[model samples]
Target chain A: MAASRERIREVVDRYVGLVASGTAAEIVDLYAEGATVEDPVGSDVLKTRESITAFYSALEGLEQRTRLLAVRIAGGEAAFHFEVQTVADGVTYTLAPFDVMTFDDDGRITSMRAYWGDDDMTIG
Target chain B: MAASRERIREVVDRYVGLVASGTAAEIVDLYAEGATVEDPVGSDVLKTRESITAFYSALEGLEQRTRLLAVRIAGGEAAFHFEVQTVADGVTYTLAPFDVMTFDDDGRITSMRAYWGDDDMTIG
Candidate 1:
């Protein structure tokens, strides 16, 4: 049985909300046990839950916020384009990346890969 | 100066329109002289305009159609998610892919990389 488009969208919305207000552990809870993530397309894949959690944990106190610009859900997959704004060293930075996420039968993210480059970063 | 968001979107919309109604040569005209393309993220890059034109030409007479699901433009870049429906060998197929396209200073597509996999294809 395939996941409904509404369910996939709800999961993506919940993910954006969690990234805004939840802890790294809480965010990891939304993924399946053996999920993987590859951010920035050509980068090394984060293969285990621990690594993925650590990656999120590093952003714990960065005052990061995301705005969903668009989202498309088909079958058990959802892809979205969004803007991430963060502040570091007294400078504000905006990163816009498109992420394609695949979900399991239980609506947990099984894999995620973000496509962006250094050129996509904007500093203000 | 960066290209306006409206310009980037117009280029993308024009590209879609050309793909739907124009020839492969016309589609290639939307790209810059030395633009590159990598369909399906990890594939070998199509380095020259000729190869890229050939790639599009192969789709000729296939009755390919694309429905834009969402598009996001920032700075000189635009990313879109769309569904491509086609029929081959008496089987109808659907492919939903997210493509990130970068534009040059003149609003011509400089690079395009599509994100998708075998799992994302459906046949009926």
Candidate 2:
């Protein structure tokens, strides 16, 4: 059985909320074991749970806020556009990446690929 | 060589424009010879040009307009949110689907997967 749309939407909501203030461990908990993550699309994929956790750990100390701009869920998969505003070293940077994610029947993310490039970021 | 960002943006713009007014053949021309299309993600993938063309032909006479809400291009692929509004029998239907497309070096689309379900559509 595929994940329900309501379940997928709940995950997305939780994901954005966690990205805003939750710990890296909390964020990684949303994924199933052995899930793969490739943020920024061209980057190397992180296939291990440890590596995936390490990747999200980068945001642990950052002052960031996230918002889900839009999302469409279908066929146990979701593609969403979300904004992440981070403040680091007194400079504010905004990046909105569109992520494509596949989920298991239990609603845990199985794989995620985010689409964004240098041109997609803004600095102020 | 990978397709340049400018070329990818151009294709996206042209695609939105074409979808609003062009024939199915014109829209299918943006794809490579053996490209595949899986609209609404869960639907059967259209593997051949004829099938893809037939799929788009459904929009042929409908009074439809399209707008590109947002788009991100990375690693020779693009994920975009776009709105398509169609008027039929005095009713308007609005659907915004997030599309992920991989491009060939020549800037032609190689594969397209759209994400949207019934909940994503609105009728007015």
Candidate 3:
């Protein structure tokens, strides 16, 4: 169980590192070919590497400090609660995002199902 | 087991039914006395029933239709992915919300942690 938690944290840490560094591609590396990213607009089911780049480009204002709130892992599936801080069009916004990651035995992520909204800014 | 899944569905169904019917009190009944609810503002560790009513009354534009997207139950904790539709201040908004429910053995929900953003209006 501890090993599973460690693996789960590693996956989350790696992905967060990418977003913190503003490198969406590195974050995309954690996803499998058929990963699905969902949000208010719709859902994305990836089939190729190129599509990953397209998906990242479509998202704007992703800067430093993307935080993961919680994680729950069971077998090949893991669910995460996240908050992403970004600035879009010169206005700062905080979006709370949740993602479910499914992985193979080799630790390669098989899918990423995400739920996020751009208008989710928090008041401090 | 099949029984566990059915129990899980019952919990979810009951909760959603309360919200869909705009019965915040009924929704409160689904929780244990000290359930914790989390959101962007902060976390609530409900020690009494009044806090639940206070929490519900604080929110505006919650007329109808609170949807639960997905649910996963393991032991005492269950995580649900949900979307709630409401109209606030004469403007329509669709909020994508998620809740994690913790229940005791008797099927009484002990806690309900909510994550939702008011700006999450779905674009059709």
Candidate 1 to truth, TM = 0.59
In CAPRI terms, model 2 is classed as: high
**Between candidates 1 and 2, which one is better according to DockQ?**
2
Q: What TM-scores does chain A show, candidate by candidate in order? A: 0.94, 0.97, 0.75
TM-score of 2: 0.97
- lDDT per model, in order? 0.80, 0.93, 0.60
Candidate 3: residue B64 Cα off by (Å): 2.1
Q: Please, what are the lDDT tens digits per residue for candidate 2 over residues A48-113?
A: 998998989989999999999998999999999999999989998999999999999999999999
Better of 1 and 3 by DockQ: 1
lDDT of 2 by residue, B36-121 (tens): 99998999999999999999998898899999999999988999999999998999899999999999999999999999998888
Compare the candidates by DockQ and give the number of the best one.
Answer: 2
Q: Sort by lDDT, best first: what order?
A: 2, 1, 3
Instruction: Assess every candidate by TM-score.
Output: 0.59, 0.97, 0.47
- Range of the 10 consecutive residues with the lowest summed lDDT in candidate 1 chain A: A69-78
- lDDT by residue (A51-104, candidate 1, tens digit) is 999988987888888888766665467778788888888898998778778888
- Flag regions of model 3 displaced more than 4 Å: A1-124, B1-3, B58-61, B117-124
The predicted structure with the larger DockQ, 2 or 3, is: 2
Off by over 4 Å in 1: B1-17, B24-97, B100-124
Q: Give the clash total for candidate 3.
A: 1
